[model samples]
Target: MPPNTTSLIQPLDQGIIRTAKAHYRTQVMRKMLQAINDGTSIINYAKSIDILKALYMLKRAWFLVSPATIENCFRKAGFPVIDKTSNVNEMQMVLDVSEFGEAIQEEDFEAFVDCDKEAECFGNLTDDEICDSVKLNRQGMADLEEEDEEEAGISYESIPGVSHKDALMHLSMVRKYLEENFTEYNSYYDIEEMIEKNALINRTQSKITDFFK
Candidate 1:
């Protein structure tokens, strides 16, 4: 059965989720080749994949939908055919798509992101877990220091004027929850990209995992 256009709007489209997962791996390679740029890329990559997988799982539709489906949808809608592939560091493979393929371009965000639909849950976790996950959110520094004994049990609401970085991380977590559980997802780049491009949570991947649990 052909997929429904409305179904494509789900928070994390299976197709994109698959692409993002691959993208994360590619990024890991890129960072490694760059003389091991830093200690945080690995963490970001892991969180990103977690995010991609979580979102993809929500779709419950893997390779079931193809890039061609999206292309056809665009062609029929009069959008220009933009051929591209995953963007890594400097080295990227560019493939032209005349025969229906998947090459998630940055511009794709314009069409795929339905602000209303973009707000899906990526991680359907409990409030306590959500609060704990905040520590992992990139706040422009490594989450290496000891948690203040008193601040450990606080919820997002309890905190006042959390730093912009913390807000971004918490929101990322919230977005993950909404994407995984809700019916809409509007982000083109996975939460990982959001973290790297605009971050405040600079903690280890293991820390992020331990935190939520």
Candidate 2:
């Protein structure tokens, strides 16, 4: 790769990384919206996103990156391609600016994706900093658990779990609403199947608990 030519020739730089970032940002925005809906402070919700939650979000974001997007990225990077159908629009749809209303603009999304363009993945660390990082990694799990517990003490409010029966009722209501409103209601079958599987698992667990009691 020539100097500053990586953006032109690199498959990742072409679209893959941008798509993943857009998906991740969409997830973050949705969570922020949920926090607002639930009356939680945005700062508190942001702080609550630990490494584990972030990893899960990133995992989903990468999983959502279509194979077509990867192929499009390679094609854009000067690679030979058979299918001429560009999946750029598919990537663009991943971050729906309309879904966020006036709170987020198209320019804001573009800026967010490009903000870390010049960021270095690896950086030089001082000897003390390196040693501290090693120490932190060695005891990371225990330290994290203690920190979470302390944080939970200050901010966590326990919400009661929904009963299986109530969950089933709500699921049925959703199914009914979709069936009545949508001509293409076949998608509800997948959701219904998932709920049924979960209900079965819960019932089995309840039986085992009853046996022990």
Candidate 3:
């Protein structure tokens, strides 16, 4: 499939990603508010967000997406539910951006929800500015070693800068940590636990905060 077609497929463009983005922005906004409340500059927190931390927030936001929401996304893409237990309107196939506005409560949420406004924001940048902001490697790997040579170079021995045994041991430790923390209760009584514990905590916090407001 072409890139455009693939992007338009069942789940990718089916409002799932937009919802996740909104959730992520909401978290960022919350952090900004917290920094303000603490008499600290929001720029510090924004600039200090490393890629790993950003990815963690995104993953957590995605984890909050409900099964029903995902099913609605599939149905929006014209895929009929297999069980046929619910009725979905054909007219409501695609979701509107405004539908996710509730996820973000900041004043700039409207600007974030506006697709044209976002495009306009980025469209003002010059070609050089855009290129400098983005890194692109267009060179082909023509001089790369052949598959046979690559396979022949495989080694498990320790080197000056790297030790394969230590690497494997570190990976094993990470696996153990994840097994104990994240995936430990993933399968309860042979049935997969859909909602994560952290997500439940977040929902509870959100509710408590909203109740007092």
Candidate 4:
């Protein structure tokens, strides 16, 4: 009984496994890491989509997620996000922080994604309840079917400035902007070549737009 380190670690390890929600969190974090490694240059932005989508999915799927810890874990994993300064800034609570080194893998990123999706389409209700929720209208049925098709993939609709189509366009524009302005930012941007060739929105625009959005 001299310190009981094993006893302490056991609780920590057990807690992580016994809690269903925690398992989900770890899964979502891992998925986000994978998304970041896709070589988009603006990987921080991609990682942001991964985290926010996971958060939304967690709540939607009826598994309560800890926002503070979730934000902390993302930062620890090396993806930068500009989260809220205080509680008053509820809107800025969820942010993407990757402005540093290469991103790290989130432990449970995928589960959170699934949770959000299921919540959006099926919700916490029983099968009958979800079905009833859908049967209420023609549009609902169509939406439900469409959701099924999209649920298995990443959720980008809920994220601002993250649409695949828009992101591609932005990358092109950002690259052109960089070519015109590369000499201006050589000293400041670590990835000047990437900035000149991949980023769509400028830093000011990316930060400001995301801040307000």
Candidate 5:
């Protein structure tokens, strides 16, 4: 695989990755709104999310990626669909820019949908601006590292938004369902452990690799 050939050959680049990102973003917004509605300070939830809860939400989004969509992506990438097309209705991600006006105050969501002539003709960045951008990115990564440490230190009993008991119950249900349906998956792993180590949810490994084998 060449450096930039993924966009041309990867099925996930066709739409599956975009779908997952959109769903994840939507879930984040929904959780933010729910916290606000519950009169809890959204800052706490936004700042330090429970790692297990975050993984569970991401898994939900991953499962929302339909078999048909996956097959369609494979076909678009010049492969055959492994199984028959899924009859299940696909998830329609509808984002109303107007609805998000208050949620994101900086710019309208539609503004980012397309790059205008003005955007394309923007002058090159100054040396100072480039340095600032690099610094900002470094700071962002540092912040993420700090957050990861915080999440690692906390246990189920200390989670903020949802109770530990509820989180445990949800995980129990998910484990039972997966065990019944996916008998080959032979691990009664903790949700916290999975998220911490980035086990089955690693996105760097492409499904396309399996197709070629």
Candidate 6:
């Protein structure tokens, strides 16, 4: 790549990367907000996120990027991309970061996303540093295995399960709230349909279990 031309020619730099970062930031913010609501410290909640969880979050963020966004990114990067009709509503990509209100300013959010832009990922490590890192990783894996074993000893029946009726009632409240507060937003119907489908599947499974009993 030529000097200073990467941004102009790279499809990711055009919009895809920014969109992914936005999605990821929104997810992080949601988690933080949930922590606050649950009376947990944000720092502690953030610290609880391990590499595996971060990978899962990144996977979800990438999956949320629409095909139309990709095509537009390529087109903006000087690529000859054909315009295709996408079922995905572009407005859905616009994140409601405003939910954080004064807690997170627009500039601070942008800074957080771009903070890693110039970060160096690959570097030569000293022999001592490599050995120390290996030891730390091994200890971390052992700790995780121990925790998993302890969790495995707990019976499934010991965990409380939500009833289908209660789940549907919660969804009803959500649907009602959205309908009243966000009259212009129509995607909540899709979410409601998806939840209802899951509830139906759960009810079918329960009936099967009863028949077996």
Q: After superposition, how far is residue 49 of candidate 1 from its true place, in Å?
A: 14
- Candidate 5 vs. true structure, TM-score: 0.44
Task: Return the candidate ranking by lDDT, descending.
Answer: 2, 6, 5, 3, 4, 1
Task: Assess every candidate by TM-score.
Answer: 0.22, 0.67, 0.44, 0.21, 0.44, 0.57
**lDDT per residue, candidate 6, 13-102, as tens digits?**
777887898888778887988899999998899877878888888999999888888887777778885565643236235455688888
lDDT of 2 by residue, 1-213 (tens): 544555788898877998999888888888898899999999999988988899999999999999988998888789998989765556666766788888889889778777898887656689999999998887997787679778768524465777777877898999789878888987678877877888788775346567777
lDDT value, candidate 2, whole model: 0.82
Backbone atom clashes (below 3 Å) for every candidate:
24, 0, 0, 22, 0, 0
Best-fitting candidate, scored by TM-score: 2
Report the lDDT tens digits of candidate 3 across residue range 1-213: 343355456474676766666667666666776776788886787766877889988898888766666777787777878755544332132233354345444445745544442342223568987686554322222223244346668533422653444555565666677778885643342322222333345453346567777
Kindly provide the TM-score of model 1 when superposed on the true structure, using C-alpha atoms. Answer: 0.22
Flag regions of model 1 displaced more than 4 Å: 1-11, 36-143, 146-213
Residue-wise lDDT of candidate 5 within 1-213, one digit each (tens)?
444465668877666766665556667767777788888787887765767778987898787777777776667778866665653224233334344547763244323322241333335689999999999999997897778668798654566775555666787888888878886644557564655355445445669778899
lDDT of 1 by residue, 159-179 (tens): 676455776777778877877
Assess candidate 4 and give its lDDT: 0.47
lDDT of 6: 0.77
* Model 6 residue-pair collision total: 0
Q: What's the residue-level lDDT of 151 in candidate 2?
A: 71
**Backbone collision tally, model 4:** 22
For model 5, how many clashes? 0
Kindly indicate the candidate among 4 and 5 with the higher TM-score.
5
Weakest lDDT window of 10 consecutive positions for candidate 6: 86-95
**RMSD, one per candidate, in order:** 19.3, 5.1, 17.9, 19.6, 14.3, 6.5
